[model samples]
Target: MTDVFETDDPETDAGATVLEVRFTGDEGRLDRALALALPDLSRARLQALIAAGAVSLDEAPVRQGSAAARAGLYRVAVPPPESADPEPEPIPLTVLFEDAHLIVVDKPAGMPVHPSHGHARGTLVNALLHHCAGSLSGVGGVARPGIVHRLDKDTSGVMVAAKSDAAHAGLSALFARHDIDRSYIALTRGAPHPRAGRVETRLGRSTADRKKMAVLRNGGREAITDYATLRVFGPDGRPLAAEVRSTLHTGRTHQIRVHMAHLGAPLLGDPVYGSGGVSPVVREAVAASGLTGQALHAAVLGFVHPVTGEALRFESAPPPAMQALAAALSAL
Candidate 1:
């Protein structure tokens, strides 16, 4: 749907305009409210604009965390126009493996693997588009040309994209069979009593929060996470580190994060999961490490070659922050 703000003149380079709007419907999202008033942009773009502090209500910047507005007369302000031309930034990427069939990339945290919503360009896909040129195979959509699977925008990990339809089919089958080996390294608040275990639960969308996933028994799909304790310690000792290697029998949204939180060991810096209760030591360590998102990294990926049928394995070391956390935990 179109966003809440629009201008009569698209070419107008006017600095900013004040728009008066009246809220309708039940207490609606601020974005929705704005989009209703401004219909030219997409909802995702509006949210990004809001997050970027480009949208102001009644001359005040709208806070992204604030509750939605009820019936009201609101004055909305729009930011200056952005450049229409998109330039590909030469962002560094870790190449795990590359072949005629597909390419496996060890994506870093905070990088969107592909273009979506407000992130239309300068994504990993865009980079691949430039790097691979005519080599990338066309998938179902125009935006996602070679994409097979996806990692979340903030979750850094190894991901595979096909170069041809045959490769895509083969990789899809392997994924369907749960043959792809995916391993992640994560730091948690407290150590589990057993130190190693498996979590099998049904996961579904949270009824209260649309942005989050929750473990549900009634109607959720089954999800599983196999975890091993890489290291364990008390408060005076080291912080706990866990190696969670998950094979998705069924890929539910946020499966690992939700299941881990259900086990009371949410990943560090996961704002949606209470930050794992943030111990003083952990908090201090995390702050010192300069991590802005969850302390999770995809460490290993393995699968049979789509065309060659040869077993292949790719591994990536944790990013700097994750490595520092590991070092601190080791000393503890």
Candidate 2:
């Protein structure tokens, strides 16, 4: 049941394929037809081949933008593979579930999903590479094997990574369509006013700052977050912190953090979206509990297995820090 498809391209010494594909389909356009027939070959690469006269129809070079009028045999020449090389590091991983097609991990806070500008090592990808032993998904491309969705460096909990190209493509599509169920637990400074509601907005890169994202009024992706205050606690029966449970309808960067902050309940230790000042009551509790960093955990992740016709749901409890903080909050 794996979503993966393989072309019978003749293999080569360098492990690359010089694909020569021929097919007959309804008359429409090369771009449209090729994409439908071969979901794996990238559109950009297909268009590149057509423009360079690597594709032909009835022995005539098909224009890159040609619109076919009828079903006919079309031939294409696909390029060979390029070497994939990424350094694998023996970093530890907290695996939740593993199978031939994918791996579900209980990712800890402070580990980035992949290498980035400021983080070059100690990432989940580096660790996964070493653990998979070369059996990670390649559909992610650029040597970013097995990576699908990501959590912020400060967020910890249940996550899934694809172990094959087909699984990668299928999972990626699932995330894009918002067909997966994902929930998070967050410790916000103040309780949401209504206690339970949904926040919907258009989100994009911040115009004021390139390094951050903002809820824009125009020209941005749609974002929606549903949140409910699980409980509110403080010292001496005074409200100090609220445990909020949130579900995502759209997966935008910092969507929950931004929406919660916009609603006037910023998360504690959120250096970016949090209120710069902390309430004295919560501050004292944090100090005593030794809690630091954003108190967000990906508590629940559920999805249909791409390679199997089965429903899969995984849950992880908050890490020690979050549990300790919550325990302290209950006492106070």
Candidate 3:
């Protein structure tokens, strides 16, 4: 259950972090083993680096899709950390609050938080770069310089970014401790069985679709979601859809949407999870609201101030599309 590694030695050639790992664990994928052996690097980042052919085992190149990394010594060559300073663009940003340490912004739907493979421009980070005027922090490395957490590209609501490394660390710890208060409002097909309840599931990459997440049976990470039915819309006296508010105890990708879908109540307009066969009323509401993505909104966020040691809470009204959807539902 322990990984013995020697990686602090200087690189033999140019910029490299030569790592010699004798993994003692017999479980998990090679990427998982590497990620566990090197806790400093994020699992996702380690997977990316491994997939990029940056590692070797026993003088043989370690394939990114290698079956597993067993109890064996391996050599890993880590290249120099990539720079995160993407070009700053004049992307509009909605600042909700700001100070020397951190800034809160109301991020719009359809805007990615940071740049990655397909999305190289017009991200929130790009806007922050332009607006912060060289004050952006670099503690989070290249993938996410000041990003503490993220919302999906189609979800709109409050998001906070760090201005200083201290704030970034504090916020990251808060998230790790699950001390931050977060709430999301969503419109889902059908009412939940209990009207309000907790959903505890082990989440992992879906076997059916690698791009999506699923409640897995084995070797998955723990995920917890709590939701309550706020209102129900069933114009013809049959339950069609409901407006629900959810609190996340653990943040996994698409946790709420996946859990709700697992409850047989997929969020309205969710292209990935939805069955595309909702009742006429729900369909009409979703279509008329101008929502081309999931009908979910991050409505409330609360946490302690990283610098000032003060409690803070912020609330945001649903976006226009959600507002329209709510109005349509209420009228039914």
Computed on alpha carbons, the lDDT of every model, listed in order, comes to 0.70, 0.80, 0.84
How many steric overlaps are in each model, in order? 9, 0, 0
Off by over 4 Å in 3: 1-84, 235-237
Which model, 1 or 2, shows the larger TM-score? 1
Which residue pairs collide in model 2, if any?
A: none
Best of the two (1, 2) by lDDT: 2
Worst 10 residues of 1 by lDDT: 1-10
TM-score ranking of the models:
1, 3, 2
lDDT winner, 1 or 3: 3
What digit string (tens of lDDT, one per residue) describes model 3 on residues 258-312?
A: 9999988898889999857797877877888898788889999999998899888
Error of 1 at 42 (Å): 9.6
**lDDT at 65, model 3:** 41
TM-score of each: 0.78, 0.72, 0.74
